[model samples]
Target: MALGPIQFYCNTAVALICGIALWTDCSSRRISNRLILIGLICTGAVVLIEVYFKGDWQNAGGRLAAGGFASFLHGIPYVSGQMGAGDLKLAMVMGLLLGWDAWHAYMGYYGLVLGTAALILCLVPAKHKPWSLPLALF
Candidate 1:
């Protein structure tokens, strides 16, 4: 599938939020609520832009569905205390980027890969470092 500028924008935006959160957490020993909220707003704006500017993306229903799915999981993770508010914000951002078959595959593929890595991190013994998956896949 041909990649569009929005995908890059979404992924970069998410990475920026996550990186900021990770940095603030490391530096201050806490996640800033403001940062998380800002990230969510940024992500939501991107989605709205895509919907308004692009065609409804008749072929991208799968991506739309994936976005909804990720949002659902984001809630679960938040409720379970597995992820922070910034993380949920990032999910919403990425979901929108994956909109309407822009990547030719469902946006969920990105989340699945990410969640799988997260699962491995949780399940893996503390001895090994977590492998970083390439961000381009999103």
Candidate 2:
């Protein structure tokens, strides 16, 4: 699957969201609710644009479903205190953007990126307090 204009837009938005999230998380050891809200607003706009301007109504439901599914799936870990709230929210954003793909390439890429980060953390020594995985860098 080649990167199309829509995909580029989605990826760019996700990247920007993650970057801000990474900065705040690293600085304060927390992800602000406001940042998440801003990200969601952007996602909503993208969805609206896709549905109305692009006339891509067919994929609308899937995109929403993907976002919901991602949040729910990630929410599990969050509830258990295993994952940060920001990461869960970011995952949803990624899904909303990529879940439109018939093959779910966005979800796959998310899993790959997250899994690689986990693996790296496991291998590296943690000499200090728990270091949060900067989701944006992934």
Report the number of the highest-TM-score candidate. 2
Residue lDDT tens for model 1, 1-138: 555676677667757766776676555545667765675576566656656777544524545665676678677867887656555655554555455454434344656977887787789787785444223222
What are the per-residue Cα lDDT tens digits for candidate 2 across 47-80?
Answer: 7887999988767787788888878888898899
Give every collision pair in model 2. none
* Segments in model 1 whose C-alpha atoms lie over 4 Å from true places: 57-68, 80-90, 93-138
RMSD of each: 6.1, 3.0
Which consecutive 10 residues in model 1 have the weakest lDDT in total? 129-138
TM-score of each: 0.52, 0.75
Q: Positional deviation of 124 in candidate 2, in angstroms?
A: 4.0
Q: Which residue window of length 10 is worst by lDDT in model 2?
A: 129-138
